[model samples]
Target: MAQKERVGVVVSNKMDKTAVVAVENRSPHPKYGKIVVKTKKYKAHDPENQCQEGDRVRIRETRPLSKTKRWELAEIISTKAI
Candidate 1:
């Protein structure tokens, strides 16, 4: 089976070999029918330590590498200038 993948922005890269990614999406409320913005954070493995805060990245799901990491850095889509 193909592994799950997500495109999100890098939120934190303080931990060695790890980065936090925030994935945001819009969803309609069940009762109110109002659009809601949802954001989720995932801990992704970054072996090269190339990802930085505010960078756009793609992560793929994998076997758990740590207590909070089940995703691995797939590719960096874009880099933050600052």
Candidate 2:
């Protein structure tokens, strides 16, 4: 089966092999019918530590690798030079 994937920005890469990504979603409010922006953060396993803050990335859902890591780095959509 294909795993769930998300496109997001790398908000932090302080861990040795992990990155924190923030994914944004927009939806209409249930009652007000106004657009609402929602952001969620995910811990993704970055085996090579290639991701950095401000980089755009694609992450895929995987078996839990740690307490809060259920996603793995799939690809780097864009890079932020350090």
Candidate 1 per-residue C-alpha lDDT over 10-79 given as tens digits, one digit per residue, 9 for 90 to 100: 9999999999999999999999999999999999999999998999999999998998899999999999
Candidate 1 global Cα RMSD: 0.9
Q: Can you write out model 2's per-residue Cα lDDT over 1-82, one digit (the tens) per residue?
A: 9899999999999999999999999999999999999999999999999888999999999999999999999999999877
lDDT of 2 at 72: 97
TM-score of every candidate relative to the true structure: 0.94, 0.93
TM-score of 1: 0.94
